[model samples]
Target: MLNWDDISREYQSEIENFQMLNTPDERNVRAFLQNCALELHERQTAVTRLYFDQEDKLVGFFSLHNDLVKVSPSLILEHRWNLITEGLTHFPAIKLHYLGVDARYRKQGVGKYLMEEVRSIAKEISNYSGCNFITVEALHSSLTFYRDRGFKLKDSTAEFHNMLFSLETLDNPTLEATPLISKQKIQEIRDKVMSVIEQSNLTYAQVAATSGLDEIVIEQMEFGTDVDVETLASVCQSLGIRFL
Candidate 1:
């Protein structure tokens, strides 16, 4: 359940840590983040959040903001039309300020899921008349995901491989997907792992001793914290998977 309210509430811990840096921590920072999340959601300004669901788990978090294009006077004559065509109601680009998934859920597709949500919301906001480019401070790992989804590089930006996906480009605008791994299902995955060990004739003591994974890690994933990629790889490897 990657809903807004749950996302906001989890930021309290993050805000606390941020406030603690070089100063005594207080509740004010958490309050600010909670308030900002609301503002962003309402204005469609950006969705800043600490990704989490119920049962008090930690997921990744991020912030998005608006950055409408600004044209230089010399370039405006030629570039203005180009900008306008791209949805320059103010300017086409919307900035991606911060984005990251929780360490545990780093590879579970939560980041992509969140990006899809952002893309959908941006498209709805665009209304086809204005707004085209989704400007993000694209991290190296994230570039492939965006590119694979049809976002292209805008020439001027470097490590920030600029990309855009036109709403008109999508074949199925009505697409929707439920979470593939729900709490119940993730629990089942783990249980299956345990069951695998059990069926292999390994004693419970041996299985537990070998797993090394703590209860908190398992519970965190089972409760909606996206499992980390490395952990999943290890888990699958242990289970004799060949997902390549």
Candidate 2:
């Protein structure tokens, strides 16, 4: 069992004692949860959600705030701008500021559960506002996790990449359930490749062997890791696929 509460003074001490001992990133997550999360929460600048285990030990937490998503002129030119936006370029969005799980709870689905909670909250936000996207500045190591959940790269800086998930994707009748592939460029490629592989008898290991690429490479590709064009071509060839 678990309990969810917004960050509050009642849990301040518990929040402070929350441990995230693993990587430099984990330490930073803990630092924010202890030092800054409450301040931001009180100011209403962001909402911080805390989750606890059956034993009442802090398990994980995440923060969120309102944001904006800007449609690039290039994208507007690529699509029917008027049909989709009606002269709008900036749309309301929700930004996930931070998501962290205690190192002790790693691999227990804590992260995924918290992410789904965020998604639910974002969807509710969309219902009342013009918000249509959930955005995040994702760490390099977590890119595959976001991508596997239907997020797409929107932009990037030296330190982090900006990724966004369209809420509209959830309402598509053709896709009754959430599929990792959204109607975006990279996701389209992922959908095609994965769909082909799922339909064929060939295993990922065989594809890697036939392509003469490492199995890890195939695994990375399937999980939305960026691979070079030649490497992608090789894998596609082995899978009897040709990108048109």
Candidate 3:
């Protein structure tokens, strides 16, 4: 089981215990979570979110802030470029300041889950404002990781590689539809998922393993967390629960 929430002082002790790979970039990630994440959060400079695993131990975290991406005209689609002013190239973006998963959870989809959450948050922000992309200053060693996840390098020669993921690749539900999701509706869905889980008498881990997903994924569904529809469908199928 894994859960995420905004960072707070109560997590200081756990944050102190958090560990990452020994590489320089991973070290900086740990240092940021310990030394700066909360302060930055308090100041409203950057908002940080922490991930905790089954034992309620802090295992991962990431910080995000609003940003602007300046690029040449050629870099953007003509229609997108046309949305900008005659001379300006700045595009609204959400910057991922730091992202790190515990060294122990590295290959178990923690990183992938964190990235998905970031992208989901970016999309939600897009519904309220003009968020066109998610940007990150990538470490050289992690270049391939980000690249494989749909981020494109803005400049290979830069000290910190600038990577961008165009949000246009994701579906943009109409504004009317966005506001239609009320808490009650969300609770109903969660209850439905729980009912299905109870009927199946299968644990989250069992369904997750059969569905090729993390146990936390099923837990998230039952807890009313926002999950991709594909994941929801897969979990349902795994439990022999049909969608109406």
Candidate 4:
């Protein structure tokens, strides 16, 4: 049986490799990598990370929401499930975020296996949350992937497809998440990153001259301005940190 240890290593490698986020004619892979890494890192700050592996490699991941907002008039913005209500808690929205696969294993059966497991988990949690919907933001390339699995587009902007599925048929979904064991790892990374930003420590400005703005942007991550996910993901790899 492939276990969580194998999955962790494989997943980390893939997130590092996620730096290859584009093709020849597609978007800027380097730029997108940073933003993706940052989003995954921040999302983990308030959400749980699920893990899964194949024989010797970790290939998939999912996030779970542990908090909820009440269901009421103000909370119900049209079909939206607002989780910021003052004091309502009948059913809460369990938002699914940042689903990705290892680049080498993308076309393999691993992604679907992990996804089905997560959906089943959501179903099991339904009794605990009044049957909340399971939702995800799908990349254009992955839209068919979700649709084939019975998910439909809930909403869409020009760039992403927001999709959903009912959690009524959750099976024995074998997955669980634990918090990362090291905040020191984060701090250690912060030091190297700070070095890059401080400039006096960098030997070569070329190496210091990266295409992404991770050093500065990280300082202001909480600001409303949009930071590039692709760029931050690359910075994470360089800084030796795993976004999971």
Q: Which candidate number would show the highest TM-score if scored against the true structure? A: 2
Model 3: ten consecutive residues of lowest lDDT: 172-181
Candidate 2: stretches off by over 4 Å: 73-83, 173-244
- lDDT string for model 3 (97-169, tens) is 9999887665467877898899999999999998888999987546645765677768765347788888876
Rank order (by lDDT, best first): 3, 2, 1, 4
Task: Give the Cα-based TM-score of candidate 3 against the true structure.
Answer: 0.66
What lDDT is reached at residue 119 by model 3? 93
Q: Across residues 1-244, which tens digit of lDDT does each residue of candidate 2 receive? A: 5689999999978887787644555677788899999999999999999999998889999999999889675754553233266677787889999998886786566777888798889999778887878889886545556765667777877557788777766665222223232236545666677788778866878876576555565676677765444455556677777743
Q: How well is each residue in 106-197 modelled by candidate 1, as lDDT tens digits?
A: 45667677777767766776775466556664443344455555555443343344545444444344333433445555555665655565
Q: Model 4: per-residue lDDT, tens digit, 53-98?
A: 5444545455555434234444245434334455654554466665
TM-scores of the models, in the given order? 0.47, 0.67, 0.66, 0.47
Local lDDT at 77 for model 4: 53
lDDT of 3 at 238: 71
Q: Model-by-model lDDT, in order?
A: 0.50, 0.73, 0.75, 0.48
Error of 3 at 20 (Å): 1.3
